[model samples]
Target: MMEAPCKRRRGDDDEDAGDRDRLNALPDSLLREVMSHMKARQVVQTCVLARRWRNLWRSMPCLDVDQDEFTTAGVSVVYSDHEGWERFEDFMDTLLCPGNVSIALLDTLRLHASSMGEDRRASRWIRRGIKYPHAGQEPGLQRGAPSCSSWRLRRLHLSNLYLCNLLAEHVRSRCPSLEDLELESCTCEFPAIASRSLKNLVLKRCALKGFREITSPPTEEPVYQWWL
Candidate 1:
């Protein structure tokens, strides 16, 4: 007896079903190595992709954002879009946390939000993002005065965030693990950054009138320091 010939599936028929699932997923470490090549803006856009690729961004652990990218995301302070304000909040809610977070999770979060001072709250959050790039599921975290958490921060990038003695002091007291800190283009300054582990530090264009160094309890030396 002759049997009927078997038929192969069409390319579109097979592909339409679903993307081939990876049986043996690549190790997170290796996968991050590949994500390192992408810029922060590109990483943010990947959220719309499949869930597997959703969190693949935070794995970079190092976030780099330029001025233009900030503007495009509607995070620029110099510009204003009544509608963008609402959209920005919605956008932030989605980027709360990237599960694969680590201490060095976000080494640099360069936020170039302009110096717009109309809405204090929105400006503050923009500044916080640059200082801390770790993503989470929760949003609406407050900053300014006591924003410093017990977490270890490797680098902080802040611009145009006005601060008072209370906020400045809070960071100096809380960020125990901060290694590199930048207060560029902001009009605020910490009371004093007394961290012995601080290697690279910058305080530029800020009202650091009260900024100082904690020398009375000072013991070790700072690898790198700067004030401008």
Candidate 2:
């Protein structure tokens, strides 16, 4: 072999294959934790890293979506174009669909939309966040109230959105696990907000021109408090 100048074997001194996959080798929980600190777009982009990470972001315990991530233009332009809004909605649906979310671990959902056009889309996304899929339920069912039996939502933050009385009522009645709710610069005509599990409510710069009152749970602990 020496006389013939033998060729070096490819693996003669190679590092372990696993060494090159350090990030992928991390535990799924740790990986998710890392992804949690990133925006929804960044989290979704990790799918391209490797086959193992393709669906890892789907199980993220927290979701943070902001319209500003897509564009810097005014809300009017962002929502006026049919194709632009459609793409935005589609992207959100893909990320926030009930099937993609990990219900048991989901704790925080933050949706921020700057314009009225995105309000409805934000509302629909919020509903899907708390929605539970029932057995035999048709896939992609767009009608009817969202099932909240499996809701584990604890913290929600909505900004620059329009909400109806029914949506507020549903959140108060259906999401028993909800503890903190923050509505910033929102437009709502709700008469009242009543939640037994709510602890901290923040209404900063919210337009409650049609509001009537804010009622807390019957508990004497005064666990619920509102901040304006």
Candidate 3:
């Protein structure tokens, strides 16, 4: 028997019901929780799966971006010279605060992209890392600004990143709510990233060029802490 003639596919709204069905069919929210834990690129690939998985990602909470995870995910990275910093740039563009997001349970932001800051591939990630939100604000950030203010962010971490001169000045004031903090193999130039409310903090192999911030021990105390 011949198949019926093809018709135009419905818009994403039509598919949203299907997405809800898939979300409903799940035994629990485990899938959503898992998706929340993965990188933005991994989440984008999931969007191509079906309407159900597509819409589900938008509601996810946790957002984590780092060189190792991006390298593992194999996104469209353009790095052959800055060491190994190519991968994370692709994600940093998609997941910044200005991006339209209804719910963002940002718990931890970490950067652990090897110690060779001058590596051609790695340096690009550092640049993108420094230049996100302001430079790569999705072009549509103006429309997304309302949603951007409601992000439920908790922790922000940076390791092995080389902050640009301009961004380095503003990093501290931008993400002050973060509690658990760690910096390793990073360069926070003069007038460094500061926070009045940090709980557990660690710094390892950092590079400071005649600039530093005084980090007072957590008065509230932490459950666990370690540094090298």
> What are the TM-scores, per candidate, against the unseen true structure?
0.59, 0.72, 0.56
Off by over 4 Å in 3: 1-23, 26-31, 69-88, 95-105, 114-152, 164-172, 191-193, 215-228
- Model 3 lowest lDDT segment of ten: 143-152
Report the lDDT of model 2 for residue 206: 80
Local accuracy of candidate 1 as per-residue lDDT tens digits, 1-228:
999897766876667555443422667566666565666567777657667767666445555543334444544443564454445445444444344333223444554445345235545554453355444312442221223354445677766666555444444655566676787666654455555456666767666666666422255555544555
Please, what is the whole-model Cα lDDT of each candidate in the order they appear?
0.52, 0.68, 0.51
Q: Sort all candidates by lDDT, best to worst.
A: 2, 1, 3
On residues 87-144, what C-alpha lDDT tens digit does candidate 2 reach at each position? Answer: 6677777765545654334677787876666676567655554454232133553323
lDDT of 3 by residue, 114-162 (tens): 4354433444543443444333233432322223323223565666666
Best by TM-score: 2
User: What lDDT would candidate 3 get against the real structure?
Assistant: 0.51
Q: Model 2, clash count?
A: 0
Give the clash count for each candidate: 6, 0, 15
Could you tell me the lDDT of residue 201 within candidate 3? Answer: 63
